[model samples]
Target: NAGVTQTPKFRILKIGQSMTLQCTQDMNHNYMYWYRQDPGMGLKLIYYSVGAGITDKGEVPNGYNVSRSTTEDFPLRLELAAPSQTSVYFCASSYHGGGYNEQFFGPGTRLTVL
Candidate 1:
């Protein structure tokens, strides 16, 4: 089953630029999240959406934003990117909600800022 998929497996950007981390799921799941994974570190949740029309910020939401208008698409937007945002971003989804622990993650989108 196709769980989650992210685009631009690798990328390089300049300072003050922006990009969107695309996230899509074919399972028709209801929960989705966008997280940034730094070198040798656990994934840090940036933003998440419980369902369409419902979104919220996570642990680290600074410089990032998101909108959930559909169950299958939850994209992460970075406005005014910085070097600090040059990390591997991952998109994930789950079939359940309310603190569900089983989350399926995409390969990742590695971004590098120069």
Candidate 2:
């Protein structure tokens, strides 16, 4: 299986612009998440879903949104992007949810908002 895949591996946006970072997994994993890492900082969760029809905001969910309509896709949307939103975005997945959160990650999408 391809595990997880994210498209447009890189992106640059003007402040106030918007974009969607696509994420998909083939592991049939039930848990999906979106996280951002700013330079040397640890990964900050943006949003996550325990399963289809279930979603929750994470630690740093500002300016971001996510949805889990299926077991395979969990895309992230950025609205009115700002320079402060510039970071490396990672999409991850794991088996089950509301428990241990060990996740399998994607190669990541680097987004630069100027």
Candidate 3:
């Protein structure tokens, strides 16, 4: 209620299946991001938005889709889920000023594709 929240704390998918990772923030942040972290690797940005109805692709946007319809919601869509897509997905939000902004992350969704 105070920060970012992601749904389905855990999930498993078969090859070619699809699912949407839900994210929402109550902090009214203007910037939101979606990232995926593989085991023992750094977090790679998938997509981001500066504000509602505005979004942009990040380092790894393939096999993923996103939309920002409201300031509070930003969901990540996985189409034709693949084994390479199996990783921990995270959602973060932050204000884009003050020199260095801090990101608030959700608990994350652990996804597995088999």
Report model 1's TM-score to 2 decimal places: 0.94
Per-model TM-score versus the true fold: 0.94, 0.94, 0.96
Candidate 1 lDDT by residue in tens digits, 4-57: 988879988899988887889999888898989999999999998889999998
* TM-score comparison, 1 vs 2, better candidate: 2
Worst 10 residues of 3 by lDDT: 95-104
The lDDT values for all models are 0.89, 0.91, 0.95
Candidate that would win on lDDT: 3
Candidate number with greatest TM-score? 3
Model 1 ranges with Cα > 4 A deviation = 98-101
Model 3 off-target regions past 4 Å?
97-99
Residue 85 lDDT, candidate 1, scale 0-100: 91
- Who is ahead in lDDT, 2 or 3? 3
Ordered from best to worst lDDT, the candidate numbers read 3, 2, 1
Candidate 1 lDDT at 2 equals 73
